[model samples]
Target: MQAEDSTTLEATLADGRRMTLSLPATDAPWAADGLRALRPVPPTHTGRGEEPPTLPEQPALPLEVAILGFGL
Candidate 1:
């Protein structure tokens, strides 16, 4: 794999799949966010037509604690 430029990258996978990615810029944080956005979401349930067991809900947190936790 090699970067063609600040906004372009080229690579050939093990299975001979050639890839080229051209981005708006070379910012690492933006690239990471883009990669994370491209990832597929996993299914919530197993494929066996059965729902996963749900856990009992806990009591809600105090408003101040919830706000602090969101910062972290």
Candidate 2:
């Protein structure tokens, strides 16, 4: 493990290329804010009147072939 010298930070690519990037360091308030921004926001609550109809469930295939009386 290597220790970081200065507060300077950069990102490394898989192609052995290094790029100077600006990113919020861990434990920083900006990092927490960034993560919170990335999270999905919940939809706003609405007044309910008529309920929507639910779809019918599909029947599963029978495992007993002989019980179904199918000709071999």
Candidate 3:
């Protein structure tokens, strides 16, 4: 199973019982006290307009490297 959130990545476990790590639920993941203690900050905002910022565009990569190394 994969946990969906700010990023996407696959997870693997060796044995069913040996998988002991626990993760915060995406739903109600942050508690008031936890968030307050963490004092998390958002990325600095930029732009003059009220519209949301678009994701940064990526450049094309070398064909061989992309295919062999990344399988992209």
Candidate 4:
């Protein structure tokens, strides 16, 4: 969908998610250029109805960094 002064784009990802983006008229040209530069690639899915892979949990880092020469 498009408004008088802006353009709206709707898209779906390979993971079955939906997204919407709105850009002002001045920046709309970049969106067109980006779309024109897209190249098709093989899909990542390997099985039907399989959930997406997730990252392993990471330990929280120590907050011992110095700020302005003063240790926190």
Q: Number of the top candidate by TM-score? A: 1
Off by over 4 Å in 4: 1-6, 27-72
Clashing pairs in 1: none
lDDT, residue 63, model 2? 67
Better of 2 and 4 by lDDT: 4
TM-score of 4: 0.32
Candidate 1: TM-score?
A: 0.35
Q: CA lDDT of each candidate? A: 0.66, 0.51, 0.46, 0.54
lDDT of 3 at 37: 33
Candidate 2 positional error at 40, Å? 19
Q: Tens-digit lDDT track for model 1 on 1-72?
A: 666456666777657999987767445765664432443345588557868899999998889999997896
Candidate number of the best lDDT: 1
Query: What pairs collide in candidate 2?
Result: none
Q: Rank candidates by lDDT, best first.
A: 1, 4, 2, 3
Model 3: runs farther than 4 Å from truth?
A: 1-52, 69-72
Winner by lDDT between candidate 4 and candidate 3: 4
TM-score of 3: 0.21
- lDDT per residue for candidate 4 within 16-72, as digits (tens), equals 887666544445555665333433467787668867899899886555533534643
